[model samples]
Target: MAIISKLTIISILVISFALAFLAFYLISPLSKEQRKEQIGEIISQLINFVLFLWLAKILLNLQLFVQDPLAVLAYPSNSEAFYLATLFTGVLLFYKRRQKKITGVLLAHSFLQVFLAASFFYEFIQFVWRDNPFSFHYLIVFGVLLALFHLLQGRAKPQNQISIVLAVGAAGFFAINFMLPYLTLFGYIMEPWFLALLLAACFGLLIKDPQDEPHSETH
Candidate 1:
């Protein structure tokens, strides 16, 4: 039963991702060919990120891994592992952007849109269907974030828009965790340091010169 439940949750997450991808296709301003190319790149990056996340999880549980690699692989990743994986993936993306392999602006904008959509769908589906505990506050946060992004469309530059969304998300999560220390993000408690790191990265992007935005990157 536990295995079945975990499988169901994973299946639901995939559905949420699919719904987010559909939202991206319907709302993105890029041409079909450009969107296709961008999707390919995004999927590649996502795969890389997931790989890093899995590796981080294993590294976090090295003893368990040494004893039974399969058991370690099946364990759920903790918050520390999530943050560490995010740090590594962020660095990788930064390096790739510096090499001009990907446009920072487009990636940030498209990712924020997709992330917001996915968060909403995932939380809503879990709350509605899952027997496990759900955070109503978490659902509201993502719903509001998605609505805010939609409302700010065209009114703000793509870079500024992403920055704002990140800031709001960081603030929202901070508030949630502070007010309810028992609450966990998904299943892992998001520490203050992790939130601080997220804000630091968001602000780092904000300080970059607006002139550096690629010509292809547009609202």
Candidate 2:
């Protein structure tokens, strides 16, 4: 069982990398030098994130590490490590954006595209190899929404397009989990209806235009 679990993890990682690479290739319109620089930045961020994860794991299991440092190396990271890593990465990204080291909108656009592609691939694998009916349904819905977003992107401003894609992706995620009732990373089941409502609110907020705001009436 352990070997099977390890193999599954390896397979998923491989697939995810392949999907992300394919996404970057399809969505990036930058020159060769620009692409190289972007890839380098992404790699650096990933390395930093990995280090943060390791640090988080060590900190979370300080007692175990203190008792047997070698044994700590053999332990798999728990949910706390992942949560800490995510929070740390989010802060890092925010700081970089604030410092003008990265363009927030462009980064969001790139990541959203990659996420959409990766999600499609994940759902495709689940449906085809795992014979999951819900995954197949999710694939169809997600694929159609993503296709529509891409088709309409050229018609809108770049920022608006990014927001549309993100909103759609969020909606797709909510819809899929609502239909399937998947557990959270911490192994707790989330309320599907609550998630659906939350995503719906986000969708509405994203689609709301600043220019559409009502003007104050003068006496």
Candidate 3:
């Protein structure tokens, strides 16, 4: 049963990844140099998420991993806003229809807008409520990185495949870090698993073949 399940999962990832890669190749406007620039911003957002957003999630779930435990019930409310904003940005892509416009907005907003809000709130809470540590830090870092992610993605300079891979890996690391904080209990990948997740997201991106038409802001 375990073997069967593993095979099923592997097959799904393979197929999905292939499609994503194809999509990227198809939609990309720039053949090579320009393409790199376009993807740079997305890569930044991916990396920022790893460093900031995921870090917050990991902290939220820290009780499961460490000694200090907080009320789990409130976590959902905290997480909900993040997920909703993420989803909203994603959905905006499809509604956009225009590849460049959609890509520009998708990469830009996802990486920046939400982060700006978080940053403001972070400072506010820190000042008002006193040192909660977890909330303030998470929001501050997440906001800054999120903005940086957008900025990086929108960079004029081109990014190489290796850099892209590293960015993705960093993004993936936080994803797994947030998802499986206590993998030690289950014999999870002890080593730096961010790279691994980046690899997987890379594969997934390739399979899905997301938009590739090297996008920049419309105006």
Could you tell me every candidate's TM-score relative to the true structure? 0.88, 0.71, 0.29
Model 3 scores worst on lDDT over the 10 consecutive residues at 181-190
Who wins the lDDT comparison? 1
State the lDDT of candidate 3 residue by residue for 31-125, as single tens digits: 55544454565554445533454445545567763654444322332443344333444444444534444344334333233333434444444
Give lDDT tens digits, candidate 2, residues 1-219.
Answer: 876866775586559657766667656665555555555666667678778888888998899999998777667666567667766876787678667677555555555555566667776777788676766766776687668657865576555776676567566666666567572322223455544554554344344334432221212
In model 1, pairs of residues that clash are none
Of the pair 1 and 3, which is ahead by lDDT? 1
- Across 51-152, the per-residue lDDT of candidate 1 in tens digits comes to 988999988998989999999898877777888888888899889878878777877777878878987888888788774445677889999899989888
lDDT against true structure, model 1 = 0.78
Q: What is the lDDT for 198 in model 1?
A: 76
Local distance difference test, candidate 3: 0.41
Ordering by TM-score: 1, 2, 3
Angstrom error at residue 138, model 1 = 1.6
- Report the C-alpha displacement of residue 56, candidate 2, in angstroms: 2.4
Q: Which portions of model 1 show Cα errors greater than 4 Å?
A: 131-134, 209-219
Score residue 135 of candidate 2 by CA lDDT: 65
